[model samples]
Target: MDVIVIETPQLGDRSYLVHDGVVALVIDPQRDTDRVEAAALEAGVTITHVAETHLHNDYVTGGYDLAQAHGAEYLVNAADPVSFEREPVTDGQIVQIGAFRVTVVATPGHTHTHVSYIVSDGTTEAVFSGGSLLYGSVGRTDLVAAIDTVGLTHDQYASVRKLVHEAQHDAALFPTHGFGSFCSSGPATGAGSSTIGEQITTNHALTDADEEHFVATLIANLTAYPSYYAHMAPANMQGPGPADLEVPESLDAAELTRRLADGEWVVDLRNRVAFSSGHLQGAVSFEYGNGSNFTTYLGWVLPWDEKLTLVGTHADVEDAIRDLSRIGIDSPDAAIGTEPRALAPDAPVASYPRVGWAELARDHAAGDVLLDARRTDEFADGHLIGAVNVPLHEILSRMDEIPAGTIWVHCGSGYRAGVAASLLQRAGRDVVHVDASFADVESAGMPMAEKAV
Candidate 1:
């Protein structure tokens, strides 16, 4: 009677490895199998089975590999129309892992093929809801159009009601994608695992609500999905697509251009305006989408061997790297902009320009206004004596706020300042970015002003 939840921070996707003495089961594994397998080996347990709640659009599923590696059964939802070497798990079928009983419940909504597994050590039933239900929200129903998503939402509403109202009281709920995922259609914070009843009472989307209302709510917030979905479907339907998912060894702009010409897909993780201005003639973008969340659609739409390169705005390569990785899309070398240090870190900072009170006074004395380009939260703190807050994410939205003149932008640790500089530069603004090195901050003896509120 042992259960473990492993969180992949890069993607905000959670995987579970449930074991009972001699028997073990791996659910919704992330990119790295070593960690899961290592845990099992360390615990002196054998991975008896591997299963996915559904065919994921986010990251590549590792169930087949785990099953192949361990000679265990690879289980998927029978409702999935795609063909695969899967043992169709029957609804309400109980799977054994030593003393633990894992029950299958076909809870389809996010996609037609998705399901949830209820694991109970005799008394407490914990549900592994792949994408059906999350902490304060429900799964997005728009991905799979095979079944009417509205109809599926209705069924999902009923399925959740059944689980919460009658099936298993105190059945702990575990979901794959949690907070900060595009697949999530409702509130996601303070979520790890919860009972069906807790979700029924507390899940805002499900509380005292009916099916029609649920469908409307889900539709309202859903943004224009990444275009990768066009490519991901066929890739998933084919068996064991590709295991060695890594970015290309070399992919400069020229190489990516060639790949696009050869009918391969290129997903630029840049914003809509930047993408619209100029991109690899055919490259589609989800720049606004978090790498992992949007990457699911990226992974689903592209082939394992397809030559793909990322064209993100300045200073998002690390995020781009991890996001694409979790969804099983390897990134290419030579990302946009110079490879800068991580967005923020605990030191004074790294080498670059320093703009302290002296320079601040000079700029302000010369009629220049300080531009604070961190995210809204970062700006909400304190800032320089006088600075205008313009977060990078919302800069494009508030282009009018930025007067047509030279503006200085700075962020904590100075990572986002470069991005703001690049974006503002693109928008034809005169921007001298304060790429402040940690040494510069210390040398200038500038007050450690909090970001603007």
Candidate 2:
């Protein structure tokens, strides 16, 4: 069997296309279906089946659309209450594609009806474990609901153990999450795929002492996932429509202003330094960089149905739209491809001053309000003394809680701090962007404290 791994680094997820030289099957595909389609063409095989391990909570699935387009059978868990027509699959059911045999194994943990598929070509075996058994970690169990966390954690443990011990112990394991994904319970010990035998020895969930201890550790380690996750389940249940890959038309300053008047989101896609130097008033900053979590933050903070106008270059706008589409954000209402200064020629521009670690320490000592924009767990691990732990995602909502003064915002790295500084400036607060490493905070002789329990 020929197994191709399609990686979505933006969301830190993977999809698989397994073929046996004549016919192929796709598992847990993202909304961008062209990649999978191209792979099938390159392999000289027809896509005969598209299967989903579960209704995804991190991004929209392309299984239904791809199946419909290719006239392939779409498979989903029989227990999931989806609105669209699908070939509902149950446990132990085997489907044949050319010389490959794909068997479904019920592994409910990440979601109530999650399953893993084992594909074999008689000689070698491969397991398409969507969110169950990851490389070195397991999927986080709390995305569904708070009440279901303990129950799901228990299921996750049993599911991983079953996959590693009972079913296909020698099969190669490929999971959708855990490479840098927030969906994982914790960071994976390493990258790339692992075999069931290897995971059985190294995976924490599979090697834990007991179910109770595993559940506790799993639940305690879950950080605040993106707010966008709340919309994914319902969207998946309703069956997301076909994605539109076309870029939107560019709007001028007057048109953008009118839209902004109607409460549309005007996102500035320039670097933090450019945004901090000067940007249109009220435009939120989300710098487009390699490591920037643009989709997560934008989707988390922006209204789902509101019109969005993005301000960036042609290349920047195209890249942003594509990245956003992975998470069900198909298109923006309009995109401004000109430079910010050109578009907003006469508009009032805002700016924020950047500060170094030494200056931040002096400001902190002088009673200036310091805000740590990292996650709460990071704050608990180690943070500057007297700094408020208002994570970047919660900054806009919790603006009232911030003291009325010059706020100095810093994240573990400087990306989020730049985002927070823009939001604070837009809110009419005097802000100083602490654009330095948080690791240097303590090394610079600044007082630090652990989170009080």
Candidate 3:
């Protein structure tokens, strides 16, 4: 059997297409199905099965629609309380696809009704351990609130142990999370595939601690996830409609101004340097690039109920829409490609001053307000001694709490700090962006503090 890993780096999830020369099976597909179909076509096999590990809480699953399009059987756990029709798979049940044998194993931890599939051709075997057992870590157990977190962590432990015992010693370990995915409990030691035997010795969840200790560590490590996550499970349960990938209509200056006046979101998808140089008043900056963390920060910070407008080049807008769609944000009200000055000729252009780590260190020592725009847990890990924590997501709501003065902002990296700087500047606060690596904080002879236990 041949396995093709389909990676969605923006959301840090993986889908797999496995084939045995005659037929193919797709597991845990995202909203976009073209890639899965392309994989099957490239393999010169027809897709006969599409399986979902669980009702995903991070992104909309395209399994149902993809199955319908290909005239294939859609498989999901029978215990999942989903509204759509599917072939209910149960534990210990094996299904044959061409020369491959697929067995379902119940692994309920990431969600109340999650399962993993073991695929074998009677010689070589692989486990599609979706969100249960990652390479060196495991999926976060707090996503489902109906089940107590303690109970779910125990379940995760048991399920992973079972997978370790039941799979072939040489079985390839393929998981849907843990490649820079927020769903993971933490980062994997290595960002690649591992074997069942390797995980038995190396996976921290399996090797390092007992159940109680593991539970506590996992719970304590989970940081703030995207606000958009609240919308994914319900949409996936009901089954999401096929996404419309078309860019929205172009908006002129008047429409853009009117939307901004009405409290609509106007996101500028450009590099931080370009955004800091000149941008439309009130537009937030989210740079478009690989490994940019665009979707996570945008989803965490944007108002869920409000309509959104985007300003960028045609390619940037298209890429932004695609990234947003992965998090279930399918449409924007409008997009503008013309220069910001052209759109709002008379509107005042805004920019924020970017400072290096050494300058920020000096200002911090001399009593200037330093705002750390990182996640709560990140701030707790290690931060400048006098810096105040105002995570970028909570900045708008907690604006009044900020002390009156010129505020200097920084994040683990400059991306979020740049975003925070733009928001602060737009709010009429005198702001300086500490646009350097937070790693430099310790090296710059700046005093650091860990949250008191």
Query: What is the per-residue lDDT of model 1 for residues 319-350, given as tens digits with 9 covering 90 to 100?
Result: 56655654545545534632212211111112
Write one digit per residue (lDDT tens) for candidate 3, span 16-108. Answer: 999999899999998888888888888899999999998887888999889888889999899888898889999999999999999999998
Q: For model 2, how does the per-residue alpha-carbon lDDT over 1-453 read when each residue is reduced to its tens digit?
A: 999989888788999999988889999998889989889999899999999999899998888889999999998999999999999999899988889888899998999999999888899999888889998888889988889989999999888877765457788889988877778876575477689988888888877778798888888888898888887878888767678877777886787766555545788898888888887877888888567878888887666766677788878888888788878776785555546567856566678888889887666546578899999989889887788989988987899999987899999889899888988887789999999988777788988885677
Each model's C-alpha lDDT? 0.63, 0.84, 0.85
TM-score of each: 0.64, 0.96, 0.96
lDDT, model 2, position 316: 82
The residue pairs that clash in candidate 2, if any, are none
Deviation from native of the Cα of residue 93 in model 2, angstroms: 0.8
Candidate 3: residue 45 Cα off by (Å): 1.8
Positional deviation of 214 in candidate 3, in angstroms?
A: 2.0
Q: Number of clashes in model 1?
A: 16
Candidate 1: list runs displaced more than 4 Å: 229-233, 241-323, 334-453
RMSD of each: 9.6, 1.7, 1.8
